[model samples]
Target: MSVIEDALAALDLETKVKLLSGQDFWTLPAIPEIGLRSLVMSDGPIGLRGIGWRPDDPSIALPSPTALAATWDPELARTAGRALGQEARRKGVHVLLAPTVNLHRSPLGGRHFECYSEDPLLTGEIGAAYMAGVQDQGVGTTVKHFVANDSETDRFTVDVRVGERALRELYLAPFERIVGAGAWGVMAAYNGVNGSTMTEHADLQIGVLKREWGFDGVIVSDWTAARTTAPAANGGLDVVMPASGDPWGQALVAAVRSGEVPEEVIDDKVRRVLRLAARVGILDGAEPAVAESARPSTLDGAAVARKAATRSFVLARNEGGLLPLDPARLRTVAVSGALAADARVQGGGSALVQPAHVISPLDGLTAALAGEQTMAVGARPPRTRRWSTPPPSATPSAPTRAAGCRSPKVHSGPTSPVCSARPAGASSSVRRCPARTSAGWASRHPACHRPTSPSSRSPRVSRPPWAARTSWRSSASATSR
Candidate 1:
């Protein structure tokens, strides 16, 4: 096959054609279980997150973000970009879910590493360079967190409550610049702006992102992000990420059919997604299929992964002249903590990833120490002392687990039905992340269950008829009924 044809063959059949063909192609029942349209999607932004067939713990990589920024080397960022993009390509991924450029508002913010910087110039410059490299090889780049996704604290339902000036100058500036730079995709952040959910906010998604910026790209709702169909579409969200479940697609389809949302809005999204397929070479068949076999490690995403990992690793304390560890005679490296064993590469909530393989620092060190004997220890949560199995990996040792953020009540698992909410007449959502669920929102106020495929467009509420539910009246609303 010619390079284009070779690339084309790599793409799933769904992504290998235009709207008519692509839609039919995507909607076809090639797979018996679900909508395994010939083509499936992989994530983007920082990297491709691989999820296991049966769901696993959230695999979060250490902060490689600020590490790349510290270098201030556009080329290195580009290299990281290329490597990540290549990883997506090898995995048959049509869209890469990354290069999250939300302007860092505070250092304490958990996702600081995943995003670029606080300054628009630095963030935009590096982001633009990164996207160019990623897209050049046919894979698409999705610059994200839309506006103000900097902090993880109360992320889902909290509104940033920013003014027009703050929103325009800082939060949305980098996105605008990157859009101008030919970024093919943009992701809506979970945070709300001006008392509106980013996913369902029309003014920002359409007025600002599409019309003012003239971004002719696909706008995918961040995982499980869509709260309502009408505003979400009118606001310009195209392909909803992780497609099926949630307050997204199915709810959207229902809204359209019920006359709650206009048909044109639906077509607009379809066209954009289809157009994206063509641009990314998915339509031409250059895209790889989303299968285990697709991620063939030629140069081994290892070499590249290592470099990316290194860049992402912040040399926080060179205090005792540590690190750039001298394998020759470093004597013994004492490792501790839960992170030491399981290196969390991504975050919880949406952007969760499942890499093909994870080489924790402990894993790397053990291999390095194989020749030379080393002391080991394995205590619960580990001591600041030793390790028995070369230790897993090491986070800042300052408590990897967030002290406050509730381990959120989400409903996902084989036996668990996907849960969500919908408008009165709308179909229940396929999947709804509990983080986005409001305290006293709806009739069911139920977490969404994956709606029946030929996915239900009929709205369903969670409350069983007999349950007398009471509201946890908050300070936000001071009403007594």
Candidate 2:
């Protein structure tokens, strides 16, 4: 038996049971007596959010999975994944909750940006490459939303009714590749698959993932996903995240004492978690990782983000071959739209990360053409629909700028190009715009208006203005011609 197995054999029933659930939100309780360290995890597919979950603690913001999928290059995906692993290491994170391989079943799916293509083949290939890269860096990667967690609508309770053929062909295909690639962990979805919640699905979690496919890694439940005790433990769930009160705790202990849950089940769960700890080099006798110094060195994250962003661009519908604009021939090209100066690097929700720097479409154009272009902040993306992650608490983190203010100022006279707007869907002062500095009010519009800073307690002002506006449409039109 391995060290983790040996340690598991010595643990009492209660200690083993405690190991099954998280000690608190975002961390597992460290079993100091056994020399097991608390393993830290962070939310991400595009990038790592780490524990602070604040904009001030910025992380590398790479292209979204959908953007990476558009590149149709597995090597590029692997490179991006390696960069993610490096970021996790810098942030002292043991596992990254990423490479969300769920398919794009519906356009209206709240998290389409977090996933790859709708096609299973593409999702599988890209996901497998990403998994390989992350594991290569000695940090564990969790391939998530196991089995039909495609949408966010009533995600906790909605039942996904899919046939076996469809499940294998579509929903499970990407996860299959990730498992086959030997991913260190898998996260069960909040929703139910067929009639049983995924956290308690014995056939898939145990019979298929562990028994048939040989996924020996830990299986962690999505936060609060485990709603019951005996079933989840018996179904092969190894960890309950966020350490809060959950389906597995005193209740699980009672079930085991009553013979509803076998001792072997508890042992198996503890063993798997211990296995994960060993793999990440956190178990006893393993050399502890060197803590990153204050201001850890960023291993060329900017270069990786740039390469991924540049390669992921697909020239769809270049009609009339109006090919790349020749800077030599163009005297003055007028670029319109606010997003031209402030690009939307990624989509909304938990996948969001505050990038160190974002090079806007206009930024690239201006640098290339030099004196050959004029930018006009004409139309913006539609604002009718809002894409936001639900706040975790009564108050959310203060907003930060996703892209710098690229809004050009034409102060020919008092009739300057200006319009007054407030924070989208706000009742008060988050409405006031700040001075013309980077990460200010211009995130939404290019108006030359200045107001006092909003209260710090307000939610983060991070909704990328380009998210709602047709910024890309305008950029493509201007550049191609």
Candidate 3:
């Protein structure tokens, strides 16, 4: 038997099932008897955010996935992937939960900025290249939100009703391409497709992804996505993530003993998990797919990020040839917008990372026009409710109340940030505001309250005092008149 097969043979039902569930927020438990080590994973489509979200261990943040897609260069995407792979090795990460290949199906999609493009072909090509580069550096990559996770509207419950033709041609195209390119892992999304939840969608996960496309890697659940022990196990979900509240572990062993789930199915999942561990070089007897000597030499992360950012620039209509402004002829330049000074270098949520530094447009232009005068205009953008760490004294069980706003009362969790608040008389039941508008927070709740000031149109919540301070570094150049 092969090394992976041998490892699988030695594991009992409970040990096998345990291996498929996360031991912590970012890792899987290791069994020393079988010569397997803990497998570590982290968030990344742009950069690796390792286990800790602390600033002291910052990552080399790259441009958003959308910006990388705009470059239209598969090679550049691969280079960016290499940088992330290098970062992964430095951070002791075995797999990168990245290269989110979900298509940009809607302009209003909450994660549009995190996606590559509206075009599936382009998304597929770039995704394939990015996945290849990461794996090339001996780090595994999960091509994610598998099969029709195109939007975030009611993500956890929304049933994405898509026809097979539209689904195949548009939504599933990129995933198919990446799988064909031999992706090492796939993350099952939170939503459902047609009527079945993705985590329990056996027909697609087993039938299409594993059978039809022949994906050899593990299919892990998006954190907390696997809701049922039997359904997910039977549905071909090879792994459930992040340990906390996961539906697997002892429940799966119980389900198998009860005949609701087959032991053979559990073995198949264990086999896949072992395969992944072997590829990442955690399994003792198996040779890693990429050796240390084969990896590309050390990369200058900032240089790679700068190149990708510059190449991604798409001047849609330079009718007056106003761009590439001649510095020699320019007397003064005016940079505008709150983003110009405080750049949102990357999209929010799991994709967020603390870069060592950021280059605000204002600083970049000011440096470029060394002698020329530059003026910053417009007020800093209103702070919308985003995930930020609470004060040190705050506990996950603590209740955060937003005064006057009819937002739902939110409780912080051990692994997640608390970014919501509730009004004085709002229902105590936990609920989130439906959505946020550019103008402000929008809600259908009758008791909804608007922000007091015009600038605070969005529901206002307290943020860490240090978050308000602006720190800028000089890098890249942007011109505006």
Candidate 4:
């Protein structure tokens, strides 16, 4: 038996029950007695978004999975994976919830940008390579959305009616490859596969994944995916993410104690969790064990992102071979569209990241052609959506009359600033943006402005919670643009 197995055998039933659920949103509870440390997981198929959703914090943004697949090269995928693993390590994350291997069954899929290809073979090969690369860095990779989670429409409750043969041939193909590649973790999807919810799907979890393919990795429920205690627990789900207020807490423990669910089921799930912990160096005094190694040398992500973009471009058509023009022969290049000046690096959604810098098409062309390029606003897209501050209400009864209610410079949006208020000789008091506070407090609140004495250092302005929900898309967009 392995050392992890030995540790598992020593644990009692109560502690084992605790292991079956997460301690927090992004991590599992640690048992210091057994030397198991809390394991931190993050979102990524392309890049890591640490525990918090702070867009300002910098993270390496690689080419999207579709862009990586467009290259049709598994080697590049592996290189991208290595960079991702290194970034995960740098951020103190042990597991990356990535390599979304679900096949692209339809174009309208909201998360198609995050997936690899419509063809299963390509997704499988690329996913295997990416998983191998990530696991190589002593960080675990989660081959996610177990089966038939192709589209985001009705993702949480949509019951998919797929034929068995087609499902096996296409949908389950990538997962089989990822399991064969020995991914350390698997995330069950929110949608239902066939008639059964994936989180509680017995056949897929116990029959196909665990028995047939021999996937020993931990099976984590998608955030709030597990709906019931008995079904999900018996169905083979190991952990519930965002640990607070989950269905399987004391309820699951009580069910096990009442003989409604066997204790062995909980033991099996705990074993898988511990096994993953041991592999990722979370178990104290246990040597870190990776299923595979990607490469010995660390890779530069920014350099790879530039190179991958070059190869991933698909030339659908070129009239009269008007392509690959010699830089010397070209005098002045004419470019159009605002996107030429500002490129969208990745699609928006859960995986969105504000990269440190993105080189627009205009910048690239200018650099390549020795500053010989001119741009024209042939037609600019209408700014249908923008977040300028509500023009300071002309009314005198507004909140501006308060002691420190000065409006800070409003840029793209009103970044709610932390306000400092002092009355008479009393100490200054600070309060975060009270926009959501009671209506009565907004107009007369004295704590709504900057410090009395502004310092040389700029005060950190924070975007409101609603800013994360705001997103826009242009009608015409190009990879280079």
Candidate 5:
């Protein structure tokens, strides 16, 4: 145990981490010199990051948290916990960041499909189940996004700004129960709670999580989120993750040395991390069995997907007859969205899974309608025909087809750009939108169209392209229209 403690002393924090990795725990690394323990981390309240868990690592995914909660069985939660823990063991992963226990504030949460219900009790019950199983398997489980990591948009910067009563009653409850159930670790969010950063706010991390609730587990800073290391450490955050490729670790050591922070603070923080590692058998002499041949399920894992989809489908309005989608007599469907083909089952960033195959609403609906008899009983099935719109024909246009292959972006630009298109069963021809009124290119486009106010200009980007291009005098003038 002193190995880590002494490393913390003589070796710089980076060197300490480097040394930890140098001591291999299990499965060999692709780069042996980098070492097996260079501090492995994983996602998935459901399972390991099988894709990048490591090429040599063997671990498959389990059901999403939402699906697991549907079983409403703590045993399932524990099994899920055990499944992930076993998977964690396979990879020699030190931290399994998971069990997103944030209360379901709204059904609109994009990631909620992977999370539990809007009720804190349900979230707590399920989160605890996962925490128990993962820790039991000798790999640490980190109950995550600590306080109010509810929304996906602007998640890192949103100011939660809630009252103490509301925070305790709703958002913090699941974490409290999970802590009580022995979650060995926690991860703080990037958002500000009531004008204070969750990582630096001594009130929640220290006053509430540590002292009040008695959470002895390690508190991890959200990836790239430890702004003031000293304040965060003093606030009860134990780890600054995900060991960003920068000199921030060096800064932490320097801060400790310069008396900006006390070494005792570092000791306390590191102790928490070490204690969990010890609990999870990381520092033990056991030669953890390296997982063999385990990878994320290649078989679409439709069972898991359908199960997850079914559980996440809330019955918000049972007003009368809007139940199961009718499979019979559902013909001549007028579809609109391109998303039907490319359904966004998951979000864009870190949580994405390279699924073996994706089943879109179009695919599901098609299958449903295909073999069924007519709306009437035993009637012969109707022949189904599907076709996208035919491209227009007019002036000579840009080549929008690759060897006559049609693409969606073909119509993205100015209608006047004249595009060569070939709809199925139609002869190749140069074409444009039908109406004489053309859709011309504005600088920013879509958002720039029909601006109501100057303040309505692009918030993320510099300014709307058309803001200056158009002859609008003032913001008031723009809004007046």
Candidate 6:
């Protein structure tokens, strides 16, 4: 028997179940008796955001996946992946939860920037290259949102009713390609595909991904995505993530005892986890797929990122002979737009990471056009003021107030805080107010109104539900891209 099988044989049902559930937000429990060590995971595809979200421990931020795909160079994508893999090793991360291969099915998808492209073939090739590069460095990669997580609208509950033909040809193509390219992990998305939730979707996760395609790696649920013990286990979800509200642990052991989930099924899951551990060099006896000495040498992250950004630039239209503006002839240059000043380095959520520094377009142009008078204007006032995470001591129950801002009530929804009205006697100066909540600050915005608790606050910012559309649109009179 293989080392993985021997280790699985030694583990009891409860221990095996424990190994399948994450001990915390970014790691799984280690079974020392079986020579298993804790497996650490981090967010990736752009940069490696280790375990914490802090500015001091910043990561080397790369261009968005969309930008990388625009370059149409799979080799470049592979190089970018190598950089990320190096970052992962430096931070003690074994698995990178990234390289989102979901197709750009809708323009309005909230995470469109995070995905590669609308074309499945392009996305697949790029994703495969990226995965290969990361794995080349001895780290594992999870090509994510496993099949058809194209849009964010009601994503957790919406049952995407896609026909088998569309699924095979379009939605599932990228995952199929990536899996075939030897992906080490797959994240089961939150939403249901067709009539079944992906975590419990046996037909695809087991029948297609494992039995047919022969994916040997672990199938982990997207954080907190696994909702049932037996169904998810039997359906082929190898692991449930983050200790919070996990469906697998003791519940799974009970399911096994009751025969709801077979012990052999548990063994299969454990076998995959142990195999992944072996590949990452965390398990004892098995030879790691890539040795530490074989990893690619140190990479210059900034240089690689700069090259990628330059290559990805697509000049949509440079009408007239305006081509490259002659620096000698140029007397004055104008830069406009709020985005020009406060550039969003990356999309929000899992893709967010603090780079050591971000060179805004205005700053870049200003440096290049030195001595040439540069004028900058915002179409709207740059959102200078915003909410931020309060110190650990400050909580919703304590109700701490920011200097010159009112103590607003904390709410439970995932909406951003908006100051509907200016606080009484407050100056127009920008203040970094804390939008306190049980889940930390959900969002931050320019402070204008007093912060209210959820109990006292009235419904504010009443716009049509569709007002929060993801597409960029401007008025007919406006003159900006």
Give candidate 3 regions above 4 Å deviation. 372-380, 387-481
Candidate 5 per-residue lDDT over residues 245-318, each given as its tens digit: 22236676777778877767776665565555545545433233222243223232345445444554456687
Better of 1 and 4 by lDDT: 4
- How accurate locally, in lDDT, is each candidate? 0.53, 0.70, 0.74, 0.70, 0.54, 0.74
Residue-pair clash count for candidate 4: 1
What's the residue-level lDDT of 367 in candidate 4? 61
Off by over 4 Å in 4: 53-57, 291-295, 326-334, 370-481
lDDT by residue (tens digit), candidate 6, 359-382: 977667656655422121212322
| Alpha carbon deviation, residue 157, candidate 5 (Å) | 4.0
Task: List, residue by residue over 324-396, the lDDT tens digit for candidate 3.
Answer: 7666544334342334555567767778888999887666776665552322121222345353222233332
Position 199, candidate 3: lDDT:
80
Give me the overall lDDT of model 5.
Answer: 0.54
Off by over 4 Å in 5: 1-36, 45-47, 50-73, 89-92, 106-110, 152-154, 245-248, 286-337, 365-481
Give the range of the ten consecutive residues with the poorest summed lDDT in model 5.
373-382
- Which pairs of residues clash in candidate 4, taking residues 3 or more apart in a chain or in different chains? 25-242
**In terms of TM-score, which candidate is strongest?**
3
TM-score of each: 0.61, 0.76, 0.80, 0.76, 0.62, 0.79
Candidate 3 TM-score to native: 0.80
Write out the backbone clash pairs for model 3: none
Cα deviation at 116, candidate 5, in Å, is 2.1
Q: Write the per-residue lDDT of candidate 1 for residues 1-481, one digit (tens) a residue.
A: 4333343334432332222121221121122122223434454455565433123522223235656676676776676666666665665666666778886665456566667777887888788878876775567777887877766555655666666776677878888888998888888876676666677777888888788888877776665555454666667676554433334434555666678777666656655654565566544333432233443233344565566556655555686766566645443344433344455555433344455567665676666554322221212232322222223432222212222312222232211111121112322223222232222222233433323343211122233221121221122121100
